[model samples]
Target: MDTKRISYLYDRYQSNSLTALELEELGMLANSQEFDSHFEVVFNKIWEELKHEEVHKMGIEAEQAQVDFILSHPRPKTRRLKFIHKIVAAAAVLIVVFAAGLFYRSFQSAQTMQPAYAIVPGKQGATLTLASGKQIKLSDASKGKLANEAGIEIIKSADGSLIYQIKDAGTGTSGMFNTLTTAKGETYQVRLPDGTVVQLNADSKLSYATSLNAAGERRVELIGEGYFDVAKDKAHPFIVKTATQQIQVLGTHFNINAYADENVTRTTLLEGSVKVFSAGTQKMLVPGEQASTRENQLSISKADLESAVAWKNGEFVFTGQPIDEIMRLLSRWYNVEVEFKGPPTKEEFEGTAFKEKDITEVLELLELTGAVHFKIEGRKIIVTK
Candidate 1:
């Protein structure tokens, strides 16, 4: 496009004179393959010179300004103009260069704007709530009797999870109940009265009744992450409920991850079969299949059983996910603050690391991707250019 034509488009866009379709066309022109390199150069100018005061207040406008400016000016006309025009054009070039520098600095500033809250994993030595509404501390003696309710006794096994089983012969009906909770850095396992087992992950809770002898279905509540091996009792089914999902099973092994901070709640089946219901929808999951619920929609897809359940077995895995997302997961599990000190780029990572690895070692391995640099000061990780 000629200088005059480009200038006209620039003015129109700067003043919001273009229609929606025209704006889209302008974006297409600005983001064209040939203009990709110089796109930022043009964007900085329009954003600084023409962006409205109110528009500038919105956090997103800086990015929009960059896009709009690129469409407004294609190339400089320094070679064709007279001395005075050339001088004016030279001054504009200097201004554009100066603005680019400021944009880069501002981009650096944007990286440090961290989320106020983080979803963290559970720690060892977490507490549990008994059927009597009694809270028991788990740090000292590993094994203890929790409670007896409805002819069933809830006990903490030598291992971390709570177990509910029938205690004595009884003619009347009775049930036991207990809940297991983990702090920000722990994992625990529980075996139900019906020979079913559950592994509780960090920052997680599981509530279950003691008696499988009841005529009704077996039910449990989950908060964070857990792997369940439901014992088969066709007459009595097992049901696991979370904030947004429910899993019903006759006899199956599966993992439910419904951490509040996570955008999606996932149910991964390992063996047998399960019916996952949520958001007014239901789907049966076969072994090696997974169900994901996001924004009140449920989707089912085949999955890798070993990879999905790896956390229960003690490992961390990433599957071509963005750096920021990976950092968020790390922050939760390790209980640390993650801050970035430079420009943010769309970079993804794929790898596995042991959950036992310290925060520094994990950051070092991530730095190997040449995508980010990290400086760890105690529990805080500062990401840099």
Candidate 2:
């Protein structure tokens, strides 16, 4: 495998100017394990030309797409290579280089037509409102005890996570509640008094009693999305209330997506059991099951756990999700407004992207599918066919 030839084919493919013969040749070369070392050298050279900042903007989805394209290339039926399995195994390592080459080419092209505005990804932060109506901006608050309410002491850890430490367990009920809210482009995690941990996604809120055991049962009202890890206390069950549904559990790990813009409230159980109540209907969900509630109707299905908690894990994992839904998510995380300029392209996107990438890079990854396009003007993202 000639490194120069490999580089030429890669450049042509990136420019969409590769001929049929060249495409086949490139595919064959990419399919061979013997040429993997040569591909690495060529790609490394290309990667060197990318600016340091641009290299950081590259995304995993783009790399995965390149790998998929290379692997899907038709093999020569008449010839069987003994190292075919080895080539398949090495594709992941090699394709990263190929993807970097693609990103470098894309970065060069982007420079010629850069958008007027760039939207950075979301960050870990939220606002904590105490029972007395005092609001503490967690993002700006120092790393130490922020407040003391009733018997709970609110502390901000070194890593920025909010913590509620019990000062006097017997001090009990104060008939007061505290709320934690994350605005657009922000997220947060908090450890409650009862040892339960709650992670709030962007554009979400969680309100709970200052003392978890004060009400006899641990109760919390949630808006938008949250991942809950309830502490076990058989005497006092954990309960989460959303707009359309209520989930009661002894001690469980689960996620609830109850955005008002969405039609249904989804409760996905990752561990233990939960009973979802909606209107007058109720359904018990086991692990790996999801309960969706809308009005008086409630249904259950196998849950996509990874997708359910992707935000909490700092990634966006879309599996055949529509363009509108994807943009809705992007709007929340990037703190941007989305407007569709034409009839929506019915394209379904499937990929995993890090939430840290700039909106431009994410949009570019989606555009690679040739299904949708985006334009940024100030804080607005205009979608087009």
Candidate 3:
């Protein structure tokens, strides 16, 4: 309960070295009657010092190795462990599960329902910088031009989307570098110079080289959600990169839900072909097939394209989906916190609703199935019997 023990457990948690027994004990202490309130106070203070940004770059194996080590080696009980250690140990366990998957129930149950995890959607907007280091923030401004950057005019449409075109130059090979970011609850569509139409979902960012090079393939890094309708370039393949997975495609229309908070990176193909690779695993998805990767494992199944892309079309659709999974989807898009008040039920729902529907209405529909109930306080949804 003191700082010393907190430091020890914090170190072990960061390094992924806490044993299963220690982790369970830590979980208990976090939600225990004696220390629940003060635990959060000490845990947050120490967490700021121990946070690491470099962990995202490592492969899935490294994460698993850490988890495996913890489960294999049990540490001895130490009265020396601090109270702060116990609180943070609880948070660290949830973080591990999130990186290892997308969601976990125990952590969800421990928190009071609030919109702690919800985020607002990002609209179509960007800042373009010219070669001269001058910047332009696009809106309905400057004739939708991002200024002439290296002789390529960076243009934004009325919809706040971006595109690049050569200006006052022969078939010269010149382009401008730009980045696109989407906030929570928003989505945008863009046609790349290569004719690839990319639909970026909320809380996602993408950056591409300004000029398309005469190269082996085209590559782009993704930090959130996006749907790709790639223009077929037989000589050049399109590659989508995430923190832990890579998706390669020729010409295809597919949606990728790979939010950093999600436990799995899902690639659902509507047409053409996509090959998903992670660590030592590879799975090729054909039209109507979907591939999902979690903790370095692969799963592929026949998919309903309409259901996969309902969000892009401004709707929510679930067909015989489990309650836990449905909560995951709602948590991200609605940007609300979820707390389970009891043991998870044997309940699942089949329904559809427009994204434009009031959050309460959607919850009402779920309640009709007689499986669950929801409480809304501001942006939070508390799950109850």
Q: Which prediction has the highest TM-score against the true structure?
A: 2
Query: Each model's RMSD to truth, in Å?
Result: 18.4, 9.6, 19.2
On the 0 to 100 scale, the lDDT of residue 125 in model 1 is: 64
lDDT of 1 at 7: 45
Clashing pairs in 2: none
lDDT tens digits, residue span 346-383, model 2: 76777777888788767766654545667777888888
Instruction: Please report, as a residue range, the 10-residue window in candidate 1 with the lowest summed lDDT.
Output: 77-86
Candidate numbers sorted by lDDT from highest down: 2, 1, 3
* lDDT to native, each model: 0.66, 0.80, 0.63
Residue 382 displacement in candidate 2 (angstroms): 0.5
Give candidate 1's TM-score. 0.63
Q: Is candidate 1 or candidate 2 better by lDDT?
A: 2
**Which parts of model 2 are misplaced by more than 4 Å?**
1-113
Clashes per model (N, Cα, C within 3 A):
16, 0, 15
* Candidate 2 TM-score to native: 0.75
Error of 1 at 22 (Å): 63
RMSD of 1: 18.4
lDDT of 3 by residue, 1-385 (tens): 5545544654565565887776665666545554433444454454454343344344435554654564465432211111122333444543333333212133333223223443343245444444355656554355566556444566677666766675644432334345666655556676676778888876677766555432467777788888898989988899988876789987889988888877887789988888889767888888899888888788888887887898888777776666777776777666666778886566555556767654654665465334566666677677876
For model 3 the TM-score comes to 0.60
Flag the better candidate by TM-score, 2 or 3.
2
Residue 184 C-alpha lDDT in model 1: 65
